[model samples]
Target chain A: MAVYHADALVIRSREYGESDRVLTLFSREMGKIQAVAKGVRKPKSRQRAGAQLFTYGDFLIHKGKSLDTVSQCSPKESFSYLWSDLDRSLAASAMAELLDISTISGQPNAELFTLTLTCLFLLEQYETSLLLSAYALRLMVILGYRPHLGDCVECGERLQGERLFFSSEAGGTLCGRCRESYSGRMVRAGSIAFMRQLIQADLSKLDRLRWAAWMREEVLETLRHYLEHKFERPLKSWRLGNTISDGLERHIRSLNGKEGKEFE
Target chain B: MDFLNYPQPLADLISSLARLPGIGPKTAGRLAFYLLQQPQISQDLAQAILTANHSLKKCSICSNFTDQDPCALCQNPQRDSTELCVVEHPRDVVSLEKTKEFKGRYHVLHGVLSPMEGIGPEQLTINLLLKRLKGVQEVVMALNPTVEGEATALYLARLLKPLGIKVTRIAHGLPVGGDLEYADEVTIARALEGRRQL
Candidate 1:
């Protein structure tokens, strides 16, 4: 067996037997590789921290007949801050979930690996949940599951202004007359523009974008629809995000009431 | 033919390693050979694994991985103790903290209340959370805006309303950085209805 080294992101892991674990990793050079860490559950395993979920690390693996073994691991980025808060953690999970579903095992897609790692890092930095939605949407586009956001798919006419419809079946923007031909939901002009921008914009500029309340919901719903259509399963992490949002609002209102008492 | 020269233990190790999360068969073979080549590396790997296994524990308060029973957030006096945000997992707390919008304690449910999966209130940390609500003025249900999330939020709302706590949900509408042209009408209307004075 040949020994090889690569930088990998731990997407997920499953227990194997009593003292071993199977890690699903996305590597920079090799794309996605599933490897085993032998006796990782034992006391004093060297690769424990490096093999943790959501950890980015430099890994040394040994080639086996069927799988690779993780021999050595060194942490590069842990994104430790994400564990402190619930919302950030859920967003990160959503990002990881996307990476897990979009990429296939043993298929080396360097672009997707880099994209997933970068998104995970950015997710740690971004405060709003919108960033998570944007990252997921952008990932789908990168993976060739992108929806149509341009001119009407049926008539081939340019979409005028903000009034446009999105046909999930048609896979792009639809003009008024073209929209009548389909049964998908209508998309606001602003949302269409935003979807276009998300597809075109650089990751660095994501922070500068100003998302309105209505636009955020639209983007989320549209993306959710696209994902459901593509993956055929609703993202579990999205549901988790909504729960956290609900908890946050209630907490804030109670605080407000306390402040109100002080004012009185 | 090579079985006579190769030790059964080494081959067994390779097979075991190959079965792990991301280890392919080739990589697993490499690892087993490496172990034979460098015995010291194996020792180091063994030790690191033992440390994490023995030392790490989840915080009793938030269900986050911590050495202490109650995490720093739960014990911190500077945080807004009166407000508690209940989330599905420890990661949700991290996302909200990045926003710098919230300043309160948290309760990590470890998992969501999924009826289809047989994950109900008993499966979560709901009781531990309710016990912490003594002085908390409000409890925010910051779950994902999905079906299960909505169901969990609604369930909590009904449970908490009688407690006289002002239960509110985060505004669901357009995102702060999203474009308006692509939004759907239902989302737009919901956002408009949930709009605040500010």
Candidate 2:
């Protein structure tokens, strides 16, 4: 077995049996690696902290016939803060989900790993959920799933002052005239602009953008639409998030005793 | 399968570990071998696992991971009981607590409503939440800004509107540090439309 070392992100993991685990890792040097961590589930395993989901670490793996074996794992970035809050954790999950979908297994794309690490770090430092949303949208773009946010994708004209439509099929924005020819959903002009900024802005600039509450919702919705259009399957975490939000709203209404005001 | 000199217990352990999230067969085998070299490590791991398994419980009010039923946040007198932020999981409550932007209570649904997955209202903590709404004044739908999140928010809005308490959704659109010029028109428009009066 050939042994190698690399910086890796724990993309996902599944239990094999009693004491072993199969890990799907995205590494800076090797892209995506499928490895087995033997006996890490056992008590006092040294690799326990380094092998957790969302853990960034230096990993030692020995090449096996079918898969790689994780011999040594030293934690580089634990990102414990991301799990400290619900919004941050979900934001992190959304990013991880996007990375999981965008790249093919076993393909080594260092850029993607760096992007994932950068985004995770940003989520840790910033309290704003909008930053995380923007980062996820941009990850899709970096991986060639970039949605059309600028002028009409159909006509290739400037979309200024026009009611813009987002055709996930068309792969960009559509002007009013071109929008008629496309069958995709219409995205408000504001949403299109917001997405464009997310795609083009640098991390430093993204940190400075002052966001309002409604604007955050629009950005998240736009990204969700694009991701759904790309991945076909809705994210599991997103669904859970919605149910809880709904139930809470209903509970609050019942407590207030007004029971007739518009909730949406 | 080559069975000569193979330990059944070791092979079984490797296969089982391979099924875990990030572990593969090779890593599983290595870990198993490592465990064989250190029985003390295995013993400590077993104890910790048992302790965590037995000690961790959901807080009755917020549904967060805790040793106590009400949890610290639910029991805290300083928290605003009238204003509640509804989130998808316990992690969100932890995030909001750090912000200091909110001092209200929280309710975790544990999961969301997805019709395709056969998850409905009854599958969540909707009943418990409804029971807790006796004197709350506001409910903030703080779910992720995703399609499902929006659908859930809308669903809650519809349900809560009829009951007459103020229901607000966490806003969506652009990031605080994003560029105006790069922003798509749809986002800009939504930001404008959803703009609040300062």
Candidate 3:
């Protein structure tokens, strides 16, 4: 078994056997690979933090007969903020999930790997929804699944600032005429432009984009439909975020019940 | 190959033991061979497993496994009901009870919010916890500091906040007696942020 080193991100981590973790890593050198981190679940294991989900690390691995074993791992950036903040954690999980489900093993895509690390790192600083949407759109572009947002896919109709629809089936924006034949979820023209910019713009320019609540909800749903439709699998991580946030909203509604009440 | 393997009956026993968490085929084989060699030990162990499985049921109030319906903690009048400590597992309830500092009763969640593992809120005992929180002044979250555990605590906090209950999480920081140099950044940061004034 040959020993190798890779700068990797721990995307998916789960308990395996006794005191071991099976990690699906996205590395610059190895692409997406599954490795077993031995005894990391032990109380005193040094690799516990490094093996956690969304941790970016330098890993020394030994190629095994079946699975690769992580002989040594040191977390360069654990993204601890992402772990503590529920909203950010959910967003990061969705990104990780996208990378895991879409990509195959041992085929390196430096773009996707770098995008994932950037998104995870910026998840602490940026609006989580925007970061998630941007990452998803960028991921699609990188994987050659970029949606047609500039013009109608059915007909080469230039999308004007009017009644527009996004059809995941058609793989892009649909005009009013196209929508009559094929149904697409009604979305604003601005959201289409926003998504276009999100996909095309560099990662550094992400902070400049103005994100609204309406944009977040609409783009999130639209991309979710498109991504799920393309992958033919449900976005479990995205659903997890939505449902948990709904719980938070339920709490807010309860707090709003005390109208005109004195502050505690 | 057949001769190299254990006999059918022994193989069956080993396989059964291997299905258990943390027990591999090798350990299971050792355990099975030991059981077969000692008839008294095997009989006693089997009886103990069956008895524990048959008798111990989840407590009606807290959902912790117990021989009684309400469990000793829930039934104990000396324990305070106003302060409720919510934990992810029955083992967590045991750990907290060991401290003896907390006189309040506990509510076991059975598990955390792990979506990657296909666990949703529906898979947990959240509804039961909400229903049983009448007159409870505070809900203390004693969950792990992992991503799933944090999300579970946040979800529960939001779901329970509508009831006008005060919800707080347990302090998670650098472990006592552990070297500062060896502590992970997450733990150290959390400790710094949560530092108390002397």
Candidate 4:
């Protein structure tokens, strides 16, 4: 069995047998790989910490006939905050799910590797809706499925005005005229403008952008439909994240009950 | 006339057993030989499997595997109706029931939100949960501490809370009676952060 080392991001992990884990990793050197971490479920196991999902690490793996075995691993970037916060964890899970669905085995793409790491880093730092929207858009861009933001996807005409439609089947924006032929969800001008900014802007500089709650809801709904159409499967992480936020909002409201609000 | 050199029925038995989780071909082969020595045991096992497969039905309210429509727990009037405990699997219902702590009804998700494996909200028993939340006041999310579990809990919470019902998760942290030295840093940190007034 050939042994090799790679900088890997664990996209998915599930328990196997009594004390083992089956891990799906997206590596910089090797695109996506499924490896087994033996005894990782045991408390004293060295590979336990490193085998966790979203833990970017330096992994030394043994290439077995069927699946690679994780021989040794040391964490480079655990992205621990994602696990600490419910919202961040959901966002990270969504991004990881996208990566798992989009990529195939053994095809290395540095763009995707960097994008995954960057998105996780950004998600940990910020809880803004722009962070997730940008990550999803940028990921699609890296995968060469970049949604056409500026012009009408059906016609070559430059899009104008407030009313816009996004077509996942058509792969981008559609004008009022083109919207008739293509089926898509209607999105407001602010969503389109924000999407345009997201496409043009760096994720690091996203903090500077003034984010509105309505814009966040619009963009998220738009992207959710877009992703579902393209992927042919609903993104679990998106639903999970939305649910976490909704639950949080409700929790805050209950804490500040009607009686408490009257006092304030 | 043996194909690939195994006894006729033994090969079939090994192949069947091999398909089960955690069973390798070698273990399956061994199990087949072991079963052959105990013919009565094999007959009983086959009968049990067939009977369970034919008889088991999903409980209408809880979605747990039951011989009855609403299951015993859901049918029981004594179960606390106001506070519902949401769990990922029916086995989780079993585990939680052992604690005898929660007196509420249960909604088994059947599985968590796992998109990688093509599992989503629609795939789970979530809509049933939503429909059942009409009269419920609080939902206790008793999902496992895994990423998928946490995601599922949050997703259900999001859905349940909007109905003006309170949603709470089972506190995640160190295990009861677990040593702090053995506990992972993340678990320890969460424990400290969620520490309540003693």
Candidate 5:
């Protein structure tokens, strides 16, 4: 088996044997590959920490016919902060899920790889809900799913200062006149501006961008609809996030003696 | 009637054995042949599997597979109900029980929040756990120290903390009887960061 090196992100990991792990990695060179980290589940295993999810590292792997084996791995950026908080951890998991589903195996996409790393790094520093929306929106741009932010998809009319409708089916924003013929969801104008700024600006500077509750809901709603329309199924992690957050919300309301608030 | 021209019944036995965890096709065939050589042992094995399947049921309170309702751990009045330890699997509950260090009841989640596997809070026993936390003062999260474990612990903490209950995670660092030199940098750092002045 020939030994090779790759700078990779640990996208997913699960227990294999009594003391080993199977990792799905997205590397700069290899798009996505499943490799075994032998004995990494052992407490004394040196590669245990590096084999964790969202860990970015330089890995020395032995190429095998069926599945590659990780011989040596040292962390360059563990992205520990992602796991330090609940929201960030969920956001990172969602990001990993998206990356796993969107990319093809063994087909290098440098822009997508960089986008994942940047989003994971930024997830640690920004509001998780806002940052998650931004990451999803920007990811769509990289994968050639960039929505029409400029003109209405139907009549190609300029969509400014008017109530805009975003149709996942129509593939972009629709003008008031064009929306009559289509069934796109109404998107807040502020959310459109925020998304435009988010996709256009440097991710590191996104902290300075103003994010509102309405923006979070609208962005997530539109992006999720577009993703489902494009990908044919809703992202599983996104569904998991909504479930947990909804449970948390209900739990909080019950604790506050405000059961059945009836607020959507 | 495959398997190098084996009989149909023998091939079916091998195929069934191959479906078990950790058993490959070759090992399954070997095991099937071995069982054929030891008829009494094979009968005993079959009886055992049937017995286990017929008797075992998940304890409604803790969700651990047990022969009895409210399993031994849940029925034990000696265990403190006020201090509950939540774990990911029933096997985890067994491991913690072996330690004999915990004196609290357990809530087995059966799984963690693994989105890739389609496991969410609803899939786990999270709702049951939340409902069971009444009069509970503290919840000790004893999930494994993986990304999913961290997320579940934090998620539970977020939900539990708001109910005026103290949420704590089992500290993960160097293992017992482990040398500091052999421990990884991350483990050592986590250990030191979580150190208490004793």
Candidate 6:
């Protein structure tokens, strides 16, 4: 059996046969690889921590006939905060979902690797929606789908307006003349600028930027359409995140007994 | 040529059994041969599978698989109407009931929120649980200790807490007879988080 070790991130994990887990691990050295972590679901299994979702670890793998086997592993970071909260965990889940759908096995992008690690760590301290939107925007940039933001994707003219037209199909902001060429949404200038800043910002210093509720939501929706256009399929986690947030909002209002005064 | 070269009917049986969760082709062949050797065993197993599949329906109140609408547990007057225990599956309800400690009725979500698996709140019975929460003071979440399970529990807590209902989760910790030295940090942290003054 060929044995090798890599510092890996558990981007996705699913239950396999009894007490076993199949892991989609992302390592700077190996890119993405699928391996079976035998018996990780068992209480005594030492690999349990490293096999968890969003965990960063050093893994020793034994290459087998079909699926690689995880021989040994020790967690470097569990991103444990992601597990304790609902929204943050779902945000991390979205990151994993994007990576899983966007990347292929055996081709490693080191910059994307660093971005994923930095973003997941920052997610522990920051607001989930803004951080996740920024991560998604930056992720697309790193993946070479850098949206043309300075000017119209079609006409190549710098757009200056209170509200700008953005098209996922056109791959960026479109001028008033080019807007009619593509069907897209009318978005605030601040939202487009926020996305541009997110794409250009350093990953390590991402939290330095404040979370603007209006800007992030708009950017996220636009990016959602952009990603679906690029990937040709909507991500499950992205949709689930919206559903959860909407449910929570309704729940919060009910708890506060926020109702009209007709009853009073 | 295929090994064993079984007859068409035998091959079909072997292929069907191999499609089960854990059984492999070799195990399926072994089982098929064993079944053929014992006629009564094959008949009894087929009858059980058909009966279970044909008769079982989700209970109206809890969503647990039962032959009757309200299920025996829902019909029982001993169960606390003021409290409800929510779980991911009917098997989980059975496991909790075996303890005989929880006096409340159960609402099975049928699944936890697992986005990667394409499972969400819509795929679960969360709406049913929400509608049934009237007159219930507390909803105790007895979900599994997995990531999806914890997330589902947290989501439900947030959803139910707004209705003036006290929502709580079953304590997640080291298993019985599990050594402290072998326990993972997540387990240890949760155990400490849920620690009580004794």
- Give the winner by lDDT: 6
Model 2, residue B165: distance off in Å is: 23
What DockQ score does model 5 reach against the true complex?
A: 0.49
Estimate the TM-score of every prediction.
0.57, 0.57, 0.86, 0.73, 0.91, 0.90
TM-score leader: 5
RMSD in Å for model 2: 14.3
Per-candidate iRMSD: 15.6, 13.8, 4.2, 6.7, 4.2, 3.8
Error of 2 at B77 (Å): 30
RMSD of each: 15.7, 14.3, 3.8, 6.1, 3.4, 3.2
**What ranges in model 1 sit over 4 Å off?**
A41-43, A65-67, A247-264, B1-123, B131-198
Residue pairs with colliding backbones in model 5 are: none
- What's the TM-score of chain B for every model shown? 0.74, 0.79, 0.96, 0.95, 0.93, 0.94
Q: Please write out the lDDT profile of model 1 over residues B1-198, one tens digit for every residue.
A: 232355788777877787787676778887888887998999999798798788878788777766676777878889998888888877778889899898988888887655323355556786566556667788888986433465567766755666677787776677666555654343455578777886
Candidate 6 chain A weakest lDDT stretch, 10 residues:
A255-264
- Candidate 3 stretches greater than 4 Å from native: A152-167, A173-188, A211-215, A251-264, B1-12, B159-166
Ranked by TM-score, the better of candidates 4 and 5 is 5
Model 3: pairs clashing at backbone N, Cα or C within 3 Å: none
lDDT of 5 by residue, A16-106 (tens): 8568889999999978988999999787888998899889998999999988999999888888776668777877888888888888889
lDDT (CA) for every model shown? 0.72, 0.71, 0.84, 0.79, 0.84, 0.84
Tens-digit lDDT track of model 6 for B31-70: 9999999999999999999999999999988899999988
Q: B158 in model 2: Cα distance from truth in Å?
A: 23
Worst 10 residues of 3 chain A by lDDT: A255-264
- Residues A1-264 of candidate 4: C-alpha lDDT, one tens digit per residue: 399998999999987877799999999988999999999876566567788888889999999999899999877777766544556776777788878877889999998899878878878677646788888888888888888886888777998777777888898888878878778877787788888888788778887887688888888988888888888987876776675466456544653564224323
Instruction: Candidate 6: list runs displaced more than 4 Å.
Output: A176-183, A208-212, A249-264, B1-11
Residue-level lDDT of model 1, residues A1-264, one tens digit each, is: 399997998876666766687888888888788899887654345565566567788899999998799988877877655534445666666677767777777778877777777777787667556677778777877788777776777778877775677877677778777677666777788988887787688887788778898888888887777786678776766665665466546554553465324423
What lDDT, from 0 to 1, does candidate 6 have? 0.84
Candidate 2 chain A lDDT trough over 10 residues, lowest sum: A255-264
Model 5 spans > 4 angstroms off: A175-183, A255-264, B1-8
